[model samples]
Target: MAGPVTAAVLVIGDEILSGRTKDRNIGYIAEYLTAIGVDVREVRVVPDIEEEIVAAVNALRVRYSYVFTTGGIGPTHDDITADSVAKAFGVAIDVDPRARAMLLEYIKPEDLNEARLRMARIPAGAELVPNPVSRAPGFWIGNVIVMAGVPTIMQAMLDQVAPKLQTGVRMLSETVRADAREGDVGGPLGAIAQVNPEVSIGSYPFMADDGRPNTNLVVRGRDPAKVAAAVAQVRAMVEGLRKPG
Candidate 1:
């Protein structure tokens, strides 16, 4: 039994909860992580409050193998993600030299005001996660990775961070169609699933050519051989129940 690689996502902003912004990061991260064999087990959306952000960051970082946070790292007064995450880890927040240098490379000295320099503040002893879309870098403290909330920037940062993560065996899926009603095949499908506890089998009903209900059974597993074997078992079971015209 291979241990599952788990991850959690924290979306920090009042805009999301207040319905002012529809979150696109969660779905994008979920799909991206799944493709790389990491199971995203939990997701949380918290307001811009410091205590709430700190608590959420602390709890998720401890619970998951990897924790990803998005939003609240901007120049606005509400951007307090860095401070909150630092507090969560009991670390000091300061303007990191590397981050400062990066910002200075692109931004003029006149533009590097207190507001913009806020982006340079990172948790002590944290490593920088590259933000190709913008010079403002994200930071990684322990298992928690802080990234930008903007979808494009988040994706770019993920490209840099994803390779560093350890992954599990990729999940495999197999599908087969049966000219039978879902109700008719439900019992056998459940029996097959019980017999092969390692694989997950799902049956979806659809209309057939003859206007009768048919089912498409899908088997998924981390092991390709196991998935194929389970699919065969389901196919055999369904074939056995086929009626002669």
Candidate 2:
């Protein structure tokens, strides 16, 4: 059986680090990859520095099955993800005819200034990830997939890349609402987790209608039977706790 298909997300840009541009990519990508059987194992945010981007790309590309980078692919002086990624891979980068042509669809030939041409500069031996929303395309080289920072554009690029990726077994999950505090179930939950080594048990705390503390026990595992079994145990534990003394 194939092992898990894991990935890391690298969010690059000074704006994000400075808190000027709030990131909306990481959570969306994580959920999207999870639904498609690709486990996002790690996430890192770095400023728009070439060395930072290069180091992060190299580190994550080797540690995980794939590394998806967002931001810094725009047509500006600060946008350096393409060059940084190329430097990490030790590849020569230049204006890609394919990317240029795609941009020409939206930008006129005469209007393709040096700044706009930056969007067309793709690393050698990289496949273009089509952008349906905007003409500027993202690229996929080796295990690194470079995308735009804009949530809508990044989402479109991911959709184009999804069909070609290798997926692993989909995770199954079951949630049990425990009308009790998370602290109340901590000991029992720990014991349950220790017993079901294959399943992941997590307790999320929330308030009921009356504003009393409560918890939602979520059981997740690749195997449906195992997840269901864990859920049953959690339900029984919660029920036992609720019994009148």
Candidate 3:
């Protein structure tokens, strides 16, 4: 890649905003893309409105290397993501023969109702994203990729789309768990972070399953050497701050 590979996610659904549907695709997509070396820098959620979808899609597609949208591709009338994506690219849309064929693999010819065929409508000049879970394929035009909102179906589409994306260096991470509190180590951790500008350092305090308070210090960077070096300092700091029982 010529530059850092980056992406953004656009989540579309009134149900999600209304709390009727809890979103599960964003975190999965983020982790999946990160593992493949594509940094997900931003995420936006919009209602079922066509204008909002268009605005989010257009903005994110230009700002990132890839923009993946989840939801609004079902048989119901509220599924307007396809048309909104088309509007974003200023392209005309129609029921694609190939998409209809995919649906036929799942739906019997006699059962292929008009509502079901609505899933086949795709933007002009866009390529189809195969949906192994359901036959209703998503489509992509330019840098924007549209996928189903359902986690399983969206994951299947991501697997299909992954090979086509341009990836970057995978980030390296190191975690050091200490029997310490965040406030007890925040000062030294902050100093370590200042010296290691290349790596990101964080301190997380949580109640362990055993009901004891503990801290986890994490270091992340594209360079393994830097991550290792920074984490070494983190371990040293934790050890030096240890209290005698």
Candidate 4:
């Protein structure tokens, strides 16, 4: 695909990997990125360990056009995303002046203690990502964009970051239904996909009126005309198969 802006999501936190918290960030970010024409290529969930975070950050940042990390940047003891990311790039971690000033605007001095100042600590040479609801900001180092784990905070941060990103062609999808089973449609769908390589064809089976299984054919692609053409071809093939036999 031309001008494809691929991204990877790094979900850092022991709560997520251990199943203590169900991750809602990945789906939200994926939908948001898709809407803006950025394709989410991969997602990795890492624990609160520094080594894991650093490794994931290093790996994803190099592979994708953008790497977005959520969680572990909080004010808690387990919040090590910033330090780990800094270590990944061999940069010093310190309280950024701008971030500190921003935090000071909202939080009291007592609130900005050691535990809280940890939120202000950012990797050197990184640009700050503004958090509108909360003053504590996320930071971007190289291709990696680190944001909060909380759904609301992450959404706010994304709103600020989305406008700055380079986006690709938005993907469009269409669906067609058939009385045929998934197995019956799979072969034809695969053939159609091969013929229209640009379009992605997916066959989903569901219970029909007679308690028999039927298939739903979904076609998605960057080009609307290509997707439509593929869907029409698949529909015609299914209709022809349903004739008098």
Q: Give the root-mean-square deviation of each candidate in angstroms.
A: 3.1, 1.0, 1.3, 2.1
lDDT of 4 at 55: 88
Compared with the true structure, model 1 gives a TM-score of 0.86
Per-residue CA lDDT of model 1 for 221-241, tens digit only, reads 898888889988988988898
Off by over 4 Å in 2: none
Question: Model 3 over residues 52-147: C-alpha lDDT tens digits?
Answer: 999999888889999999999998898999999999899999999999999999999999998999999999999999999878899889999999
> For each candidate, what is the lDDT?
0.92, 0.95, 0.92, 0.90
The TM-scores of all predictions, comma-separated, are 0.86, 0.98, 0.96, 0.92
Candidate order by decreasing TM-score: 2, 3, 4, 1
Clashes of 2: 0
Model 2 Cα lDDT, one tens digit per residue, 133-198: 988999999999999999999999999999999999987778899999999999999999999999
lDDT of 4: 0.90
Regions of model 1 farther than 4 Å from truth: 175-186, 203-217, 236-245
- Residue-level lDDT of model 4, residues 105-206, one tens digit each, is 889978788988999999999999999988899998899999999999999999999988889998787888988888877777788889998888888889
Q: What TM-score, to 2 decimals, does candidate 3 have? A: 0.96
What are the per-model numbers of colliding residue pairs?
A: 0, 0, 1, 0
